[model samples]
Target: MWAQAKSGPLPHPITAAGTAPVHDPVPGELYFWPTTDVLAVYYADLGQAVPDPGLIRLGAIDTGLDDLAHAGRRVTVRIDIEGVQ
Candidate 1:
């Protein structure tokens, strides 16, 4: 699943540069495109390749992918940090 900003890029505090941008991402992988401020979560391999500069690796989903795929096309998502308050 991927979401792009309709108006413009959203404000963020990420200062880290892209170290390992991937051309082909696998399932359960997470990525953030800095240029477009788009966030994506791979539930399955779409057989698509990312453009140049590629996508910044965020992390991976260890579980609940099946639930995600079954949640239909649109769903609200909430991200919770472990210790950041």
Candidate 2:
């Protein structure tokens, strides 16, 4: 889970693939990476991008306005998704 990722710094930076409307990601759009089983969220109205190749858009987290700059800092990921099926 995300708690594990937060145990330490990430190996690489999770940058926005490109700039998308912060509004595009509400508070429940989650992206899950099956390869590593890692989860991320657009917690803020910053931007959007594929942190990795196997990244899959799963759901979202309503943590509210948290930064997504991962490297030396740990990030808490909470996600929720709806209408997938």
Candidate 3:
């Protein structure tokens, strides 16, 4: 998922620099790119390689990845933290 703002670059909440950046991302993995300020979710590998500074790993999706893969291009999504309100 490459989320881009219509007006300009998206604003990110990253205060510190990337600790562990990766060039290759796997399925169900979540990453944040500081360069574009975009959040990404990898549901499948399309043989894509991330550039330079790479991607900062946020976390992974534990379930419903199949549903995500089949959700098509544009779909409404809601994210909820397990314990945070």
Candidate 4:
């Protein structure tokens, strides 16, 4: 999407929406594929190293460092917590 938007390249279903199609960012598009799907969505990098899509496709991960920028960084996460009965 980012590449296409920047390059004017397009996908199979180009439409009035332009090269980049629109969709809600959360569960709508996030889970559009199985974790193993051969697709990705990218965003701005906050001074981080450029990520290798191959590494991401293979589930390679980064080790978080206790840096000044991340000193108080924390996230509360929940997943699949409902309808388990």
Tens-place lDDT per residue, model 1, 1-30, is 342111123346464373877878877766
Q: Pick the candidate with the highest lDDT.
A: 3
TM-score of 2: 0.34
Judge candidate 4 against the unseen true structure and give its global Cα lDDT, from 0 to 1.
0.24
Higher lDDT: candidate 2 or 4?
2
lDDT of 2 by residue, 1-85 (tens): 2221222233444544543423233334554444454445434334444343534444445445334434335545333345555
**How do these models rank on lDDT, best leading?**
3, 1, 2, 4
> Residue-wise lDDT of candidate 3 within 1-85, one digit each (tens)?
3421111223446633638778888777777776777666777777778788887776677887777677766655444557656
Candidate 3 or 4, higher TM-score?
3
| Alpha-carbon lDDT, every model | 0.64, 0.41, 0.64, 0.24
**lDDT (Cα) of model 3:** 0.64
Across 1-85, the per-residue lDDT of candidate 4 in tens digits comes to 3321111111232122222222322211111122223233222233333222221211111222123123332423222323458
RMSD in Å for all candidates: 4.4, 9.8, 4.7, 13.8
Clashing pairs in 2: 17-49, 28-60, 29-59, 29-60, 30-59, 30-60, 60-79, 60-80, 61-78, 61-79
Instruction: Give every collision pair in model 3.
Output: none
